[model samples]
Target chain A: MTAGYVDEMHEAFQTDLVYRSEDVPLECSPKPKDLEQTLHGLMKLNGLVIRSLEEIAGRGANAVTYRAGKKFGHEVAQYFQKRDDVEGALHELSDLLRGQYSFEVWKPEDKDSYIIEENGETFIYLVFHDCIVRQTLRRNGLDQGGPLCQTLFGYVVGAIEEITGRKAKLEIVHTGPNACLKKLVLK
Target chain B: MEIHVDKDACVGCGLCVKDCPMHVYELQNNVSVAVRPNNCMGCLSCHEICPAQALEHRGIYAAKRHYIDIHVCEMLKKVI
Candidate 1:
């Protein structure tokens, strides 16, 4: 299953490369093993990032982010299934990444400072660096950050599921700011 | 030859931006605008999946236009 998935992803990537304005990186390949590691690592890191976001966003913001992330995750699965090559998967995932979500950070309007809220809550802050990344990804619909993140998390989990042949559930919402999970559920 | 990304058709998916090993593509207003077209390595990636087919690689490979239909390419792949 992993090999199959990698084959498909590689092809998808190649197909996707055709849409590029330039030659694709010669580095892109059909390395299922590398892709597998990449997906798993990314999923883990995203889980961590969301936890950090919850801590920063406070007040059960986890639920909202989790929900959004989960939706995006489903899309990634669909993306992989749809494309026969890496390019197709990437393009499809790119489309998914275009989906909209909201994230906020501390601002002068709310308060120039951060505040911890109830539920072990704290200030709802949007990091400037994050915002920059988000804006850049969405700037020209090129990066698809939110959707990509959600889909990537989902893609990795789905890939794992395919590999293990065991159903895994991930519900990420309300896990607290620092809570991490193997699954995500919106609200 | 030079390649130009039709801004009107560009969805700015950034696939081109990231795919361009040459670092020739960039995102502008959620659309892909080729800033360094002269540096184009003449890869047809952008032209193939513009969704709107918004990219045209002129100059060198211009004559190769219509060399392969995408659907045909996919079909041929299955046969080969």
Candidate 2:
């Protein structure tokens, strides 16, 4: 991107512009099937691009994508008001990171607690049950926890850091077809 | 959260036993059983890799799989 474009995007995060959403007129509304088709096609294209980058950029693809995701996620976090506590941030973020990217603060059924405290730090597990990134990877026959997955880690860390004003880190605990588990540490 | 293992359909490949990150399943007497069902996080990696499709997860969150094409799902329904 050009310097001017980057500057404009950065400036957008500082704006207080309130916008209103209006329903699209019936004539302008796309058909449900057509929209699904478009979504599927775009995701497939996204998969292709990720795979191509994996092949071309090799290991560096992850760092680049992670940084990009962090920058974007930090910007997106501006939409939400900051919080005082990690638990409050988690409660609020679980809602914000929903719908298209449905996430749940998860724990084992046998475990009485989901969050653990140690060494003045808090740890929690976040499960990605309906992630677009997972869908895209699976759509293109790619493995989980690849470079694309790093973007999610970066995004979560960025968002949590911004919301709580704390340094947060995320680690992949497990990944599967349906859901992936990640551990977030706040200090 | 009940995990059902169909012994009739199980080929005893032990893929589920190997693939589950939580080590939830174990092969006993040539059948897969949820030996550590309490540990299962419901990721369903075992359900996906089963060659015989013998495992079933009930009362678990079925993650949205909108990535599957509508047309392809229909075609699979016809073929299966």
Candidate 3:
């Protein structure tokens, strides 16, 4: 009975659109088959984000700090320093999540999406986005020329799964004036 | 066998520590200190991942050179 509900929910939710940007497609579909491969992809995407910022810093640009609001009150600051491997970043993120962001929730919305407080102020939304990654880069400064189309959200979802060790209740929403994929919360 | 860290250019991201097949690094405060310098097989992985270009490995064959920027080196050492 539970399995039927899950499958039904998955089918219903996966077809919705999250956000639309330029030419990027919506991540409103089923996830990859293997979890490990998806996790590796997420790590690589994380690496890409870091590498992009590093490239900016390499050109003599000072590190820029971004605040993801209080939900992510912590600051992501870059610097010129020794390189550590992928494990280093993963470990750091693990520590940070364990120590700081274990509890955060989204602002309440009356829509179908349910908002639940996990621990503290941390909010999780399993939102689907058509192209927030490319949009974010464009906003940061990259032209990406054409509508940047890539599917990177699955990897992020996989990463979150690995971190939390819980199955995500996925959802897809349509395009919006802004690029936001899904809203996830601890289930 | 000399180990040098370009303190100023060091972004201190700690990728080297993770990549170190020899576990030669640890974070002291926010900086990476080579706890086991000898374990560095002189691999350049650390140098490549270093966003700030702060680390370099000089094996027996390689000569001393500026892996990271000198300006950064000057700034970080004092802060450390």
Candidate 4:
């Protein structure tokens, strides 16, 4: 990564830590999928929603689309949180979603490493390879950085909040065509 | 992971080299080659950027295949 880009990302993360501090309520019902057919149907619906939003709003509507996507993710996380602790919920959710999307989700091995505390802030890392969002964007002739793809980012932030019961902010550190590394910091 | 560069179709545009975050592809003899197979994250960014449809990868984590339009993928398979 270029130095300027790294600096920009650092600044964004710092700003998120300072500005986003309101926690969202966790009162949602969790829905777990028991069948592959159900998973496929859900993914299809999600793809449709994102595509329709992109078509209607064009590139300029990424923020709105991403916010919508994150809301969906938060709901999904709530469902998992009902059955497990924060770490367990995150792991189980990642496993279930990766199966639906056919992607690899790599998390830190050491449990303590999963939560980072520095300068009075806490964060978690979620790294994905072969993301379906990236694939879908490419199919639609869109770049990885496009607004349609922000849905996944929103999803991550929402889900993390549901699991941790704390407001969090997502910072995308690296986004390539097939991979993305993000940090979700508690606000 | 193994990346196959179709010599016949490659126009050597160097897009793969420019787009890959891991520096996995490099220009060799005017063609793009996957010099760092282990570093390949299977993101398939290079595959998407290839104008000539010259790239194929195997043994990488294949994300949900449904993202590609079924008809378009089938036609590309036949052509490539």
Judging by lDDT against the true structure, name the best candidate. 2
Name the docking class for model 4. acceptable
- lDDT per residue, candidate 1, A52-141, as tens digits? 665677645534654564554554454345433332433343344343322222222323443325354332222211122233232223
Indicate the TM-score of model 3.
0.24
Cα lDDT tens digits for candidate 1, B1-77: 46767777677678777765456678878988777776553435455545788877666422111112345568999
Model 1 segments beyond 4 Å from truth?
Answer: A1-187, B62-80
Q: What CAPRI grade goes to candidate 2?
A: medium
Better of 3 and 4 by TM-score: 4
Cα lDDT tens digits, model 3, A98-169, are 421221222223333334454563334432222334334433444321122122323333344444444333
Instruction: State the displacement of the C-alpha of residue A58, model 3, in Å, after optimal TM-score superposition.
Output: 37
Docking class for candidate 3: incorrect
Model 1 chain B poorest 10 in a row by lDDT: B60-69
Each model's RMSD to truth, in Å? 20.7, 9.6, 22.6, 17.8
- For every candidate, give the share of true A-B contacts it also has: 0.00, 0.76, 0.00, 0.41
Would candidate 1 be rated incorrect, acceptable, medium or high by CAPRI criteria? incorrect
TM-scores of chain A in all candidate models: 0.25, 0.79, 0.27, 0.57
- DockQ score for candidate 2: 0.65
DockQ of 4: 0.25
Candidate 4 chain A: minimum summed lDDT over ten consecutive residues — where?
A102-111
What's model 2's TM-score?
A: 0.82
TM-score of 4: 0.56
Candidate 2 lDDT, tens digit per residue, A1-187?
A: 8999999999988858565587445563477656888888888898888888989999999998889778877888878989978778877777777775778787766567878775787798887888989998888889989988888888888888889888988989889988888889877
Local distance difference test, each candidate = 0.44, 0.84, 0.43, 0.68
After superposition, the stretches of candidate 3 with alpha carbons farther than 4 Å from their true spots are: A1-187, B62-80
